[model samples]
Target: MTAWRCVFADGPVDGKVVLVSGGAGAVGRYAIQFAKLGGARVIATVGNAEAAASASGAGADLVLNRHVDDLATAIAGFTGDANGRGVDRFVEVAFGANLELIVKTISPNGVVASYASDAVPEPKLPFWPLVMLDVTIRFVLVYVMPKQAHLEAAEAINSALEAKQLTHLIGRTLPLASIVEAHEAVERGDLGKTILVLP
Candidate 1:
């Protein structure tokens, strides 16, 4: 629902350049797939080799290390827009940490759909720059999404699943008795999805 809301709610992503930050993470991975499925060119950023591989597997056209020194230049090069007019849509995981980068790289009138901001829960925005770019900042929380949005997302997900267009990555699966272990893994930021099976 979060991915669908971020990728499709604003408009069709066809032919657009969509950037997914933390593209190996759960939401980021889904966003990458959805953007690709919608015919958008996708660029995903990750912190490690494993994450880079995961994002690539999820169908990102370009996967870059988020810690690169000149991220904006790299993005511009990938988009082939020398003018630094970056992605049309951004699915951000660390909105606060990436605010400056977003402001620098997002195209005019682009939309930024952010789901998490653990790094800085309260971030100060570069108001003038964002305003000048006419950027739309959307904070998404799946639990509070509108009923209609949920329905729309569910339908899309079902269609995608039926068509075998979606894939899930299970990092670990543990019996119900091992729930505490599963919780610990999640707290440690284990990669992929963790599932607890009921015996």
Candidate 2:
């Protein structure tokens, strides 16, 4: 909810293109659905065919297999432009690793709203590329968000959940005593979300 509203707050999102990276992950999955619900065409990137299926199931208009496809070329074709004149909003997960690609693939004045950048804790950003595009890079960390924004996000999330527009994919569930197993299941990427029940 916050991802959809905050990233595209500056402009209209209806009929726009939203590119979600790591679309099989928890956040990406919801972003895909939210973008679709908002009438935007969604293009999602995934690590494999299985993840591609997951993204597609989440209502992504196009699912790019990053392992096999040329991402830049794919974006160009998907957007119907020669220069890959890219997406209006980017819901980024691997911000550090894909920073350069984000710069190249976002439209002028686009927004790259990222929540994670663990790959490069201290990344050296490319000043020129960002300045040239006049883009906005918004980092979303729920813990530090303003109270109002947090409340809005929570309300939006609840609405979506209540409407059945959002769903959690629990890959595995184990009792609290098996927390170690739950963690291990999470490490095995295919399992969507591992749950440790307290009882």
Candidate 3:
């Protein structure tokens, strides 16, 4: 629901340059797939080599390490938006942390859909820059989204599943008896999703 809401709910993603931050994470992976399936050019930012690989596997046209890459230059070069505006839509994970980069790389009138901001819960925005660019900032919370939005996401997910376009990255599968171990893996920030099966 979060991915669908970020990628499809706002507007047409087809042919747009969509940027997904933390593309190796669960939500980021789905967002990348959904944007690509929607006919958009997708770029993703990862923190490490494993994450880069994961993002690439998920069909991101380009995956850059946010910690290492010169995001502004790389994004501009990729989109050929020399005037400092490149990304058409941004699926943001760290809204506060990436605010500077987003302001520098986002095209005028671009939409930024952000889900999490744990790092900076009370982030201050560069109000004038965003306002000057006429950017739209959307805060998404799956639990509180409108019923219609939920229905739309469910239908879209079902369609993708039927078409076999959606894929799951299961990092580990364990018997329900090892639920504690599974929980620990997640708490350790293990990559991919962990599933616990009932005996």
Query: Count of backbone clashes for each model?
Result: 0, 0, 0
Q: What is the lDDT of candidate 3?
A: 0.93
List candidate 3 stretches off by more than 4 Å. Answer: none
Best by TM-score: 3
Ranking by TM-score: 3, 1, 2
Give the clashing residue pairs of candidate 2, or none: none
TM-score of each model, paired residue for residue: 0.97, 0.90, 0.98
lDDT of residue 27 for candidate 2: 83
> In model 2, which regions exceed 4 Å deviation?
1-12, 188-190
lDDT for model 1, please. 0.92
Predictions in order: lDDT: 0.92, 0.80, 0.93
Compute the lDDT of residue 27 as modeled in candidate 3: 96
Clashing pairs in 3: none
- Candidate 1 TM-score to native: 0.97
Candidate with the larger TM-score of 1 and 3: 3
lDDT of 3 at 197: 98
Q: Which is the better candidate, 2 or 3, if ranked by TM-score?
A: 3
